[model samples]
Target: MIQNKGEMTVEEVRLNEGHAFLKGKLQADLLYVGEEDGRIYSLSANLPMEETLNLDGIVNGDKMCLKWEIEDLSIHIIHSRKMNIKAVVTFFASVDELTGVRLPVSLDDETVSVQKKTMRVLSLVIHKKDTMRLKEEITLVSNKPNIAELLWYTTEVRGLDLRPEENSVKAKGELFIFALYTGDDESGTLQWIEHSIPFNGEVECSGCISEMIPNLEAAVINQTLEVKPDADGEERKLQADVVLELDMKLYQEEDHEVIMDVYTPFRQCMPKGRKEILESLLVRNFSRCRIADRIEVKETQGKILQICHSQGKIKIDKIQIVKDGILAEGIVRLKVLYIVENDEMPFYSMEAMLPFSHVVEAKGITENSVYYLHTELEQLSTTMVDSNDIEIRATIGLNVLVIQCSEEMILEKIEEIPLDQEKIRNMPGITVYIMKPGDTLWNIAKKFYTTVDEIIQMNNLDGDEVSSGTPLLLVKKVEE
Candidate 1:
């Protein structure tokens, strides 16, 4: 019942190496119109953006996601006449960013080595001919009879979906529009009107590999809307021209394995231990949360007639990883529009902040895991239940990705093995030994001052296992 013990040496080894970059032009077409003007003219555009990452590959390494930036944007007037106008918006984006490392196998392979020195890069060049086009006209909702001047507008893209296609990738999402303008009622009194419009569109990325997973990230960088009165219309009509710039990035996830440690217990050595940092993905999950609340509209503003529009934003304040789940806390910023009792200024606006707490079910989450969370306001609605109270209901989408980075001490190899001459010389030349259960070749060889190979050669052993009461021939190694 002697326990075999040995000291060992270890070294760190990197298994795979690669680099990441964008291989093509990231393009999106946004076709929209002003709500107030029947005829439109482009004023100015600016693109403000936020960076995002998405994982779109198989569980194994070799799937690619896209990381991109908008370098240049342009808007062209395709058709400009009367109250109706059409324009084409183009996004010239660069996809040259790398996300976190992707490792395929967790900790199963022993001999496999992966060292990712540089990430892999995929490039896409989107020409005008390859660009996807979106066309939609927004109807104006206003109590005023005539449109005066379109002031400004803002747009947001939400509920984005990236799907892998045959030699391409498809991006699908919704657009939320907010427009403000001055208008005249029947009495010719100047008043302000705010309107919201929702639209949907899809874009296809050509020349993409079928195996490539498109991780799509989009943001509205710049938007411009202008209103111009059309003299030809019998009724008081205006032309509205709208322009927007959107930026997108796509990324693919890569996975592989590397050898962490190696050891042999039969030899006596002063093994040096070394520490190495290993990185791997823990979990990726998507969940939907519903939030319900009430807000009071002051009576001085006016009696609530109808809920016209609602928009919301979610900010993640804190995230904690606990056993079997994740705890998330955040605040929801809401803005609602309602019609008033007066016809002169029929629309009234109100803002409210709602705090929320939610627990997402994620198995295998631990305190040592690192995570990234993205929250989106998917859908929002507000209803005027009474003259003083407004009912608000919203759906938020949360996407989380977790990664684990841990340090491990590995055993490389044996450095030295000191032999005992006296013990070797006293060993028997030939002996008939009865094997018992739980007997191993290494243990028996060590007891006889011989090596496992020598015993195997002497007794013509087929395998390392031995049965109880089985006779074994032991011949000690003779000193030359």
Candidate 2:
């Protein structure tokens, strides 16, 4: 086999009590040289998959998100026309629940005082998954050769631009299409065509509006290219159909006056607290990194003559948050087909794994930050350096979206009861108090069941701000 490419698709996702059911399929395209005729040929295969996953604290009505990757693929040849393909797929699932804290803003008793704070938080507006279909008919130029038989092809979706609308999203991108075939000439030589086709489509997304923050992801899940006859009855036109999968998440910014601490001076009150995490969108960046290397060919393989076609895929192994930005380490799997200096076998192919490390600039990224990164091969080319080495130059595109996560103690509930009368009555009417480190006027007032204004008035202070180790007089309030 010369080369193979595979992709995964999720057909259905069902959520039940503490469990999730997934239905998907793996599609692969393979290219190989024909043993009988010594010509290039192609084969396609599909493998259906069904899996049940156990999820803790998951229900039917909760929102669940899922993602998958092709961890590994191995192809074994058993006979001349049969092979065993093994694929290891990994799926990640998550559920997002909307949790809130209820804070007491006011007390019924007139003598009680409440402390409030204003906080900015992120609120999720919508989370959904959608799909879009694009179709186009491309005609070859006059100088290019007509297609006789197509052996291999590849499609890449890049430069995606999305805009929010009232009830949908406008998406636009370019498809890089490449195909290798034998021309309709007597020579029967290999000919290839490459083109960049621009396409735009609209996705129906409920509750989507303009000026909303959107974290969107798109992928070319399925595509097809076929040769067709033109109006003059010549095989000069090609029909292209593509399907794109969209993962959309939108958020809105809101401000609320939350009660950080609550205490009632007229009675005893305590706040029941719980830890909650809040996440906000930091930045969305699309960056590019270049890769260049040389592959040395051994004498046993063959001698190169001319380059034909090259294809590649990027696989990210690890990502880390560093001082300057996010560091991504990964490998690029590249396959090249070329003409060899031989009569029996005129074509040869080779595969190489090139390692790379790149740093994406993110100014304020920390350890607590979360990121979603996707890598793609924007451009790749192979050139013959000498008889035994090939030079490879490629451009890798990086799309990253980062969010900041922070934890806060939220007041879930507040319990209030009557104060102890004996303790209040035994307290002295007048006394001298000395301030210590980390002392605040509000803390002292809450301890004595008084107000900050009364403390400042009794101490003859300028304001609530007071230094440590300062001596002041305290007066207990008496029932009128």
Off by over 4 Å in 1: 1-136, 139-148, 164-169, 180-216, 226-274, 343-345, 409-480
Whole-model Cα lDDT of every candidate shown, in order = 0.52, 0.81
Tell me the tens digit of each residue's lDDT in model 1 across 1-480: 000111111122111224322222222333233445422222433232222223333222443322222222334444443222222222232223334323222333333222222322222222211233333345454445555555444455567654556545555666556554545554443333344344444445555554643333444323334454444542233232322222323334453333332222223334445664554555668898998998888878889877756777676678888777788998887767666787545656677888888877778877777665667788777877788899888888877766566665444442556655566556667888888778866667656655666677777888766677888888765452
Model 2 segments more than 4 A misplaced: 7-25, 47-66, 72-84, 94-111, 161-170, 209-213, 280-288, 298-305, 320-327, 359-370, 379-388, 397-407, 425-437, 455-475, 478-480
Superposed on all Cα atoms, model 2 deviates from the true structure by an RMSD in Å of: 3.8
- Which candidate number would show the highest TM-score if scored against the true structure? 2
**By summed lDDT, which 10 consecutive residues of candidate 2 come out lowest?**
100-109
- Candidate with best lDDT: 2
Q: Locate the minimum summed-lDDT window of 10 residues in model 1.
A: 1-10
